[model samples]
Target: MSRERFVVHLPVLATDLAAAKRFFFCDRLLDGRRRCPLPADHVGECGPSRHR
Candidate 1:
């Protein structure tokens, strides 16, 4: 087995690696095998983004 095979990829920002390291998704399990599409640190509800 190659060492590369053990590497795991994660979502990260290029400009702010420090912040990206701490970033997290809502990942809340929703109905019908769906997940809450929001950031873990989102201010509003834990659903789709509201259009202004």
Candidate 2:
């Protein structure tokens, strides 16, 4: 059997989501590729958390 490879993108909390999004949008448009949308949960102020 053969296995396939995949990529995982961790979401960074967006303290400045609007600005971050504008930068990313322009980047993607200039690069000529569309990517997955950012989730709403990651927006706003970010703080450290314990993930288990």
Candidate 3:
């Protein structure tokens, strides 16, 4: 039998797996195929997580 496989674009190290699992980021889809760059539990309007 064949098993389905999946690929992870961003891979975390085994040692950091625990921390990585706890990390959260906003995944709201935006126009032009962009995603929100804020924390997953952010409040107010969704916007960039940084300012330059």
Candidate 4:
């Protein structure tokens, strides 16, 4: 197998990333398919962005 480089733009902002992740990855968006972009043990009151 070989790797190729690609450049795809999402045209999004900081706030947009949060919204998209929530809407697409969160269980509330899909049919009970829960996902977290951040680590499971990393969640706190600060939020995802602050976790990183």
Point to the candidate with the largest TM-score.
Answer: 3
Candidate models: Cα lDDT each: 0.63, 0.43, 0.68, 0.40
Ten residues in sequence with the least summed lDDT for candidate 2: 25-34
Clashes of 3: 0
Q: Per-residue alpha-carbon lDDT of model 3 for 1-52, expressed as tens digits?
A: 9767674677655557556644656879877657887777677777767653
Off by over 4 Å in 2: 1-3, 22-52
Which residue pairs in candidate 2 collide?
none
Using TM-score as the yardstick, the better of models 2 and 4 is 2
Among the numbered candidates, top lDDT falls to 3
Q: What would the TM-score be for candidate 3 when compared with the true structure?
A: 0.48
Instruction: Flag regions of model 4 displaced more than 4 Å.
Output: 13-52
Cα lDDT tens digits, model 4, 2-51, are 66767555564456755655433222222233333443344343223343
Per-residue lDDT tens digits for candidate 2, residues 1-52, read 9667687666666679675564342112212344434333444333333243
lDDT of 4: 0.40
Ranking by lDDT: 3, 1, 2, 4
- Name model 1 segments beyond 4 Å from true: 1-18, 21-23, 50-52
RMSD of each: 8.2, 12.5, 8.6, 12.0
Worst 10 residues of 4 by lDDT: 25-34
